[model samples]
Target chain A: MVSEADSDEALMELVKSRDQDAYARLLDRHMGSIYAYIYRMCQHHNDADDLTQETFLRLWSRAATWKSGQVQLTTWLHRIAHNVCVDTFRRRGPDDYAEIDPDTVAVTDDVPDDDRRRAVHNAIANLPERQRTALVLCQLHGWSNKDAAEVLSVSVDALESLVARARRTLKRELSAYQREICT
Target chain B: MTADEFADLLDCYGTDSVAWPSSLRNEAVRYAQVSDEGRRLLAKSIAFDAMLADSTHVPVAFRLRARILERIATNESPAWWSWITQSMWRPALLAILPLVLGFVIGDMTSELDGDSTDASMFLAFTDLENFVELNESTATDD
Candidate 1:
């Protein structure tokens, strides 16, 4: 049995050797976080589920690429998940809930409280693919700028810039929404 | 140091102090306490964080895990290429087997030259030396 104390590096080594037990342990360890991150990025439960499975399936085929001391296994998995999301979006359009960066947050007369939450989600979803990815990994998932940059395959400065642009967009949209709500 | 710069950090990083770059957090906090604009901007950012916090907790179905595990169980083994890697010595040896056999045969032919009437007969690669001699007769004729 692959124990909880066993490092992901150790588990991955065993996985490389065709150990079923090690693969299962790794699946159990990472599935939750991977699912959540994918779920947030894609915003569809079924797609998230498929993406999560695909991510691990990818790990099996691509296990040799993961070198220890270079990145945390979790970060590598997220990178896979990120690619899956980008590919999915490229294939199909954005989820309806978050179609575009909703510059105006259309509110005429009736303002239900739910609109704020929806607007935030749409704002998150509508971010350009890379910016959305950077925001999800760094903001929602709590990855550092460096780790997030490594996963995104960009320099830290580029990542910081994506994050800055994403936040600025969100801040501008939400600020407008806040003004609309108050007045 | 400036409220505008700190506000940008707040916009990028949100309300969480941990999210802010460590070098700037102290200066940011100091600025927030002293600057009216800093405090006001943080309050707005906090509202955004609050809104995000509500919806991010998407609970995945527990059964989803079982499906993933089952898929893993169905095809549970290293890739075909891995076998070539794990027992790499086997292929390495296989590659040199022809060379090793040639050297052994050469050594044996020279050493056993006087012992055998026909060097080609003994030198032919087959377990049954007589069959090798017969096969070589045809090979040499060709």
Candidate 2:
């Protein structure tokens, strides 16, 4: 059976030409993944929904400037989501939530798991902005390190270093959990 | 690589979105052979990465696919402005320019004609002086 990914390139071509049908088709195809990614990144349903809409608005507005093969349109959307999340972070201020334990906070869409997932997410949330972004792109999203690096505008080696540091910090923070669960 | 170095690398292994290099694979295998502890660390890292990979959660409301598509459809369609700004503006400017030039040229020519009329009247007085000089010379000659 034909897949959505195959048609995405064609839809993008239509989008570039301002073909509303194609753009609509593109949205239909990719909106779920886009929304999911944004939701995960923001961990706020309202913000994710709003940011997803904003992301598409930007995609539509910049459609004319979109050049195929520069980046996958999905990656482009993620980059937009990344910026929106960062903007939200700045607007909400550094004191958005000080002294909160990442381990205790639950940001699930449905049934709540224990604090393990919460801890992972908290570790993600507490990361320095770039490391958090890099971790989200690489770890949470399952994007190739190269693709994540491309989205972040960093060399692969630099990206590796960021991931290393982020992981080390997470390992330290969640070490207690690891000992309980793994060892 | 030492145990500490292997542990650090394992911690970083699954965290990056980038593909693991073949060289890294070799390193992992080499480390695995040198120390069972390293292999065990790699197993833990891989398990953690798998958990992250499996953590995608799409919201049910995100099925606003229809609405999203409709938004893209209605909003991005080529509109009146595209043609008005991109296609029509320059030609419209070109078309209006000659009419503006015609009005300007007409005003300038009218002013020049008025000035020419004044200069011609002044030249007519000079012609009268020449005629009077001719008559005085003829009377003297007679």
Least accurate 10 contiguous residues by lDDT in model 2 chain A: A105-114
Tens digits of per-residue lDDT for model 2 on A36-91?
A: 77777666677777888888888877775566777788878778878887898899
> A17, model 1: CA deviation in Å?
1.8
Clashes of each: 0, 5
> Model 1: residues >4 Å from true position, as ranges?
A1-5, A93-98, A101-104, A107-113, A176-183, B77-81, B85-142
Model 2 residue A176 distance off true place after TM-score fit, in angstroms: 2.1
- Candidate number achieving the greatest TM-score relative to the actual structure: 1
- What residue runs in model 2 are displaced by over 4 Å at the alpha carbon? A1-6, A102-112, B15-18, B50-58, B73-78, B83-142
How accurate locally, in lDDT, is each candidate? Answer: 0.78, 0.70
Q: lDDT tens string, model 1, A1-183?
A: 756458799999888876768888888889988998888887778888889889988897678778998888988998998888788888886554446544437644654556766777777878788998888887788778888999899998899889889888877766656554444
Candidate 1, CAPRI quality class derived from DockQ: acceptable
lDDT of 1 by residue, B17-106 (tens): 876788888989888889898887777776666656664667765677678777877866646646655454657978999999999999
Judged by DockQ, which candidate is best?
2
